[model samples]
Target: MKKTVLPTMLSFYAPDLREQIEALPEGTALIGISASGQAIAVDLDAEAPHVLVCTSSGGGSTTVLRSLTAQFLHQGAHALVLDPKRISHLWAKGLPTATHRGNVAGIHDALVGLGEELARRLDLADSELDAAPRLIVSVDSALAALRQLTRYWETFRSKDDPHTSPAVAALEAALWTGRAARVHVILDGTPAPGVLGAAPHELFGTVILARVTASTWQRLAPFTGPAPKPSRHSSRGHVIQQGESHETQAIWMTDADVVTWLTDPDDPQS
Candidate 1:
């Protein structure tokens, strides 16, 4: 069905998809398949909040997120992502981007630097964050580098009380939603307890889930349920999924295929 019985709340987490989808707040809408790079929300229904989840391993580095973010930016949000190599630079397309590489000294500088750039992008002079999704991409070397500073490393924070885990907690606070640009964290599954794939909250807009299957695709909502509703014409039948695959296999979840909110009862558009 093009539109669900009600407004849909989506969640996607696997190799445990079925378990997560069963326990949303009730009547939550989620969509996912073993295949698909990113999930998206494209509704003009201004009365309520709508989100799309697109999670995967490297989908963070691909155009999937860049384009999705560009759409949000166009919608007047300050889109943000934390890319390690500053690769998000290519996606900037001339939008002003202030970057911070965690210097060898202390990551405190990097965080402060990011906070300043965020202040500029969000248009706050004294660096007070407003309650809107302003896009901000804070590309850093690694969470470990920032947190586990060695004597040879430059990111030692006086805040590092050996007893307290400041770096881990600080990173978590920064990435939560309902704050700035609906933050997205990019990690190559190497940070151990703090990888993006196994995070605490799945409130992110989209995550490049994983590619464990044949030429794997991105998973939209891993923490939430992914309701793989067939296309409108085939909700009762089977519809072939189309698209090309490479570096990041590209696919389309058209308005006809995914569940949506009702703003257009006559036709489907994306």
Candidate 2:
């Protein structure tokens, strides 16, 4: 079956981070601008809370992450960023609502913190209390981070211990329990089967593909049939969610815009 090819560039009114934040409804995050100029958003309090974003180098995935993180903070959510590369997420550091982890150990610790938070929320649920504030765990180059985590486990864990690695266990625990506690995780990297264990799809409600190859598309979105032809000139990409697919122009933000969003109280000019 011939796959649908998205236009090289989808023309739409792409809103900056501040504009998107102002337009967001409570509990929803503006992800990007749809082809029809509508804001594409996901509900943080409902639906699956996990998001998997796949992109090649220079595919604008970082921009998506930045936009999403900003929106999460705009909604008074706490964002924990795990960036093993130590470079991509530098902008997120020092934000009051963000916890930035740049090393494997830091990532593991962050996951452990998330697990503890989940436990606390579960306890609150038992007490019939309201859900906790939303938590967004954004991991940049997640594939690399997972791999580094395994290495970290080999070095620190007992050779004879018979349990899942702490990093994986913590991550899986968050994936399993975070939805109920309003904790969302965003993973950005090339998709690799079994990298996060079986049924990785169970962790994510939405998947976004940017400048990926057919093989990567097959591994990530096989249900969509054949992969769309590669388009070198395209900044627009595809989003798959709840079995539906759409072409979207991922919102772009400049460094100045990000800083303004983080520091300034006034609305930024788009």
Cα lDDT of model 1 overall?
0.33
Please give the range of 10 consecutive residues that has the lowest summed lDDT in model 2.
Answer: 6-15
Candidate 2 lDDT tens digits, 8-110: 5432224244544567776677666555555567776656778888888777677778777776776678889888888887877788888889988888888
lDDT, residue 243, model 2: 65
TM-scores, all models, native as reference:
0.40, 0.85
| CA deviation > 4 Å runs, candidate 2 | 1-20, 126-131, 160-163, 190-195, 233-235, 267-270
Worst 10 residues of 1 by lDDT: 233-242
Task: Give each model's whole-structure lDDT.
Answer: 0.33, 0.71
Instruction: Report RMSD for candidate 1.
Output: 13.1
Over the stretch 3-28, how does candidate 1's per-residue lDDT look in tens digits?
32311212221234334333322212
Best by TM-score: 2
